[model samples]
Structure formats: structure tokens, C-alpha cells
Target: MASIRRLVLDVLKPVEVATVSFARELSDLDGVDATAVRLVETDREVQNVTLVVEGEAVDFERVEACIESLGGTLHSVDEVVCGEFVPEEHVAHADATWLR
Candidate 1:
């Protein structure tokens, strides 16, 4: 079976939650080796963030729960990286032309 190597998400969250704390929390999830959180936009009430999660196999459900528990909402799953063996070149040149 293929495993999830990476995931990128668009998230809307309250301002109280620090991105570092959020990233650290996600890093603790099963199969998640690392996490990167970037603040795309910010407002008085909420923050828009780009979340990048990487690991051998990322359990998305758990990730969602974690976000919710932290008073955040997952707006969308923007990118996903999954395979038994993901090559670096493939990641660099990700085109859906193979579907043709």
C-alpha cells in the first residue's frame, strides 16, 4: 500500500494559536516526521495559514482532529504526496500529464 509522504493544507485558525505550536503539535502525530506552517494572511480575528506536513505516512484524519482541537478549520487540502517510494525528481516536476 502507498503511504503519505507529504501534505499541504490551507487552514483558517484563531490568532491565539502560534504557528510554531501548531507545527509542533502536528509533528507529534503518528507517521508525521516534520511540519511547516506559514502565515499566508492575518486578521484581527483569524489567521490564514499554509500547512505543510511530511512523513512516511500521514494519517489525515488525525491531522484534521488536531487542527479542530486547536480551534482551527481546515479550509482545503491543497497538495498531497504519497507513494511507497517518492522520488525527488518526481516531486520537482509534478505534472498530471501522465494521466493523458
Candidate 2:
């Protein structure tokens, strides 16, 4: 069975620099290592931006809380994606790593 991890991504208020930093930080997460978490479109009219996050389910809630703490509104959270590693694929390299 897969050890499913959860994740949630939050978009901090965007200034180019802040968005860049957020993207970098998110890339270092456990399951989803996203190189980009960008504001695609915005309601600059009201300051609402459509932010996209590429990450995993295991770390979802914590990530959501983080965004809220950072002054970003979490508009929605859906199970957008999932991932799993097959142990059988590692059989050939069983002695090569510790995760198995």
C-alpha cells in the first residue's frame, strides 16, 4: 500500500519577489516539489489573484494554514492530484537507498 501524504498550497500576497520566494520554498517540500507557484490571473480590481500550487496531499492542511498566516486567503482546496512510489521498481536497487 502507498503511504499517502497530504499537502495544501497557499498563495501569499504577491509581489514578484514574494511569489518567487514562495515558489522556491515550496519546491523543497516532501512530496510536491514545485518550481513554480504563480498568480496566473488576478482580480486586481479587488486584489484577488488566481494562484496555482503544484504539490501533494499529505502536506495539504499545514500548507493551507501557512498561507492564511501569511496574509493570503485560501479560496478553495480540492483534491487536485496524487502520487505514489512503487516499491517493486526499487527491487533492483534495494540496497542502494534507505527509503525502501
Candidate 3:
């Protein structure tokens, strides 16, 4: 089986949990080399964030569990890269019609 190299997730977390702490915890996970969390939106109770995890072999189950432990909900998986290498994503002009 191929290893998971990267994962992009949409997560909703309680405002009480600081994004820095959340990101640090994820970065500490085994097989995870780094994590980047970007705030997408926020409200009084929750924060919407996009989390990107990159590593040699990211463990999805562990990532999910960590989010839940921090009182966060995984909204959706936006992107996933699995293989021996991570490739740069390319978008053709025709495929980006919505950008105009």
C-alpha cells in the first residue's frame, strides 16, 4: 500500500482551543513532519479552519483522534495525497474557468 503524504482537512473547533496549540499537537504526531492550520472563519463558539498535514506517512486515524480530543469536528477532507512522493498540483486554464 502507498503511504499518505499529505492531507488537507476542513475542521471546526471550539474557540477555547488556540490554533497554535492545536497545530503543535498535530505536528508532534508520529509520521507527521509538519502541520499548518489556517483560520477560515470564526464565531463566538467555534472556529472554521483548514488544516494541512504533511509527512512521510501521515496517519489519518491518529489525526482524526487528535482533533476529536481537542473538541474539534472534522467537517470534510479537502485533499489527500498518497504515494511515495508528493507532486505539485497543476491546474489547466480551461479547468479554472471559475477563477475569472
Return the top candidate by TM-score: 3
Model 2's TM-score against the true structure: 0.48
1-100 per-residue lDDT for model 3 (tens digits): 8889999999999999999988999999999999999999999999999999999989999999999999999999999999987788787866666645
lDDT of 1 by residue, 1-100 (tens): 7888988999999998888788999999999999999999999989999999999999999999999999999999998888865556445355556665
TM-score of each: 0.83, 0.48, 0.89
For residues 1-100, could you state the per-residue lDDT of candidate 2 as single tens digits? 3333433333436343365555555555566545445455555332333444454433665555556655566765533444553123225555577775
lDDT of each: 0.91, 0.49, 0.95
Off by over 4 Å in 2: 1-17, 42-52, 55-58, 83-100
Model 1 stretches with alpha carbons more than 4 Å out: 85-100
Q: Model 3: what TM-score?
A: 0.89
Candidate order, TM-score descending = 3, 1, 2
The true-versus-predicted C-alpha distance at residue 7 of model 3, in Å, is 0.4
